[model samples]
Target: MSDDGDDPGRAGTGEPAPAEVGAKWARDRRNRVFLRRALAGVLVVAVVVVLGFSVRTSRLTDESGAFGPDLAPVMDRIAAENAEVEKNHPGAYVTVVAMFPMTGSLTDIGLNRESIRHGLEGIHLAQVWRNRQPSSPPYVRLLVGSDGPDDWEPTVEAIKARTADEHIVAVTGLGASTGTTRRTVESLSGSGYAMVSAVITSDELTGVRGLARVAALNSEQARAGVVHARKVNPGLKAVVIKDLNPADSYVKTLARFYTGSLADRERVMELSFDSSTRFSGTVLDVIAERVCNSGANTVLYAGRSEQLPALMQALSQRDRCVRPGMTVITGDDASEMNRKADLNMWGDTRIRLFYTALAHPAGLTLPGGEVLTAIRARFAGDDPDAFPRVFPHESLGDGMAIVHHDAMFVALETVKAFAREPDVPSPQDMANMLTSGTVAVEGASGPIRIVEGGARQTKEIPILQLNPDGTSAYSGRITMTDGGPGRS
Candidate 1:
């Protein structure tokens, strides 16, 4: 009462009332509580998103069966037939095992599976031909196995085990990567097994007594690519970016051959990175800087298809650094880069990209066209719906499928030749028969000639150019001669 203003509702020295102070404290507490709940909610959402992404990636990389849903029944029938033949006449049936990559880069796994399916169809066609011969031919059965992505040991052991009990005359597939093929070859070297790869293109695999390939050697492909690049831009300065994967010996060999193919008039520079290396912003910046500083009009990339999206992104970011006439050249993996899902990433780049593939042009009147036609007819007659799944309607010109069909054709022919011999040949004898350069089978792609040193003599290579509209066009063709690559 002495005007001290010490009541509970008022401050003692001109401060706010007690009620106002309590209200402000309550509001601050409420705001802090709300903020904490909001933070918790955000953290939960972040975890969920991360987990969902991780699961999706895991599913994509998981190991899959050797055959797709549509083709598994076909394989089952072949297996049953093989069992019956073995029961009736031991060692009378020749078993060919196709080793494919069921898990790895998503694009590769899918392509490998598709190739295997079409290759099996080709074998079926060969079987029909053999049955119609004047004299009965030995039964040929195909079995599929997967080597996964990173390891080939399990698949190798399985092959060895099957060989011990069955008449597995030859081994094929494992062409998804050079490392897989090399490891399989090494495993079967002393084991006396014959291998004819559908797509393995490494020159290093040449001269392996028991191995043959349908696709051109990686070096050959590289030479073709370089020749085409030079033709497009005469006296073009090029910078080659090679992915160094010890497992994929093809990449290293490609880099070496490509750089060597450059003429003296053209300046050349080589750079290397590992397959596992991520193309981060910093890395792309460095690559762009290198290309601009070197004054290179051409950039050649020799690596996996999975890496192309990142490379395209990197290149797009450095559009300012890229010269007006810059072009990118790649190898057979170009189809992977042309996926529809990746259109947005590569469409805006506005850069000229050309890639070389082991393919024959569509609508070409070639000797092997008959075989392809026959195979298609057979597929239509057998299972039309399933045929579309294995041989996708759009994959009439898929180089991988074409090569696989050719490989199967060669393997079937080799087996047919051995079955006709007076005496049953040993596995080593069969291997010799394939690599001896004495057998030639005409296939859908071309003449399947296993020349000296177990190398396929590829006659033509298709070059595809990626347009700004996300469409690919057949730019031209290159022919590989005894000396080098020439325009077709």
Candidate 2:
């Protein structure tokens, strides 16, 4: 009983027997090995997860490297084309970048592509007229592409890279979406590149330096919509369907302006849906119930072109809201309502539909009218029906196309004016000149005077109504004096 391994005396001695001590050390060694292996496995998993994320991010944001296709070939083509123009005319060639949304939620209906074609045509026509005198004909090289949606980081990176490497002096063409144009301006403004938008009407961009918009402001459009709604129904009860695309703050802003502009006699019910949401039967039923309960005789859709068709279909199916004398109002995004599919949606509906836009060719009267007529005449020589093709939908007759033309005209004129100086101003200087409100140019949209603070001083927005027979006719015009909303 006194043996060291078995006796209690060993425990009281403050030292274990040799066999017991060896066993205890072995147990501690096994636990340490297990912990080390567990930590190694965790580290391996963490590294793999990080690498996967990095690859995904690289593919999304990196355009210059192998992660995405480089736009160098496109740039080369533009340069080659400009070089040919210079070879014939022998003038100082100035490169202008045209950034279009070729791919995104904005281009779902092919309007962006059509806009690109029209914008390029406008630039080329201006070049031909300006190049008549070989003394200093400006040859414009356009770098065009779609900046991806959401962050548009890929397109922004490509633009920055091209601006640095290609010597781009000015940029145009951000399409109709406010979100796209805002992100684009923010990206290029830092680099001192001047930008012009064809149809971006966000009030938020009013005072942004280095950016000028040719279209009417979103607030102006909303005011026009309210004016037209009240005209159609003196005591209008309206339900507004707002497309809540976080990227496009303009829609929400327009809705707010519309609500605030309403008179005490009028009542407005506001409802919002994300542009990406696909409305199901339950959702549509809820919307229909809301519209019915609100007793709204007019429905205003403030959203993109793609969302309108589904919304119209959903609302039309609800008998309560699809009755006679109901009025539906929309903005320029619905400019293509004459398209085959969209036209059919309004074919038998008893509700009246109207949209607001700049002047149509049929009714456009300004000093710039002659310029557009000349350009259209030249285009007609090649194809008499080119106008219809450019603006296939809506009877507005290439009104949006004319806006694009005006955008190019403004950009070219600005650059040409700067070129006349003894020393060409830097990009920032040119931007300052534009935003200074001193630069007044005759554009297809009429006399475009960029007022101090970047608002284009122009009057006249046409409201086109869709007849029951599926044809659009001019309803009225909204004219702004001193940048305040007034309908004529």
Clashing pairs in 1: 201-218
Clashes of 1: 1
Segments in model 2 whose C-alpha atoms lie over 4 Å from true places: 1-83, 89-91, 107-112, 133-135, 150-155, 158-167, 280-285, 336-338, 365-398, 467-471
lDDT tens digits, residue span 1-488, model 2 = 11001222245566654335434433443355356557866765787788754222221111232211333333343445566764653323455666665556553322544444555455444444444433333445555556545445676676565553334567777665556666767877887767777777777777777888778887888888888888888888888777676767667676776666677567567887776555533454466567766778888877766566556666666667666456888777666554334346543366677888754654444333433444444333344334444334323354655676667767777765553343334567667777778766655555677778667886577788765444567776777767567746
Best by TM-score: 1
* Positional deviation of residue 173's Cα in model 2 after best superposition, in angstroms: 0.2
On a 0 to 100 scale, what is the lDDT of residue 272 in model 2? 73
* Residue pairs in collision within model 2: 338-394
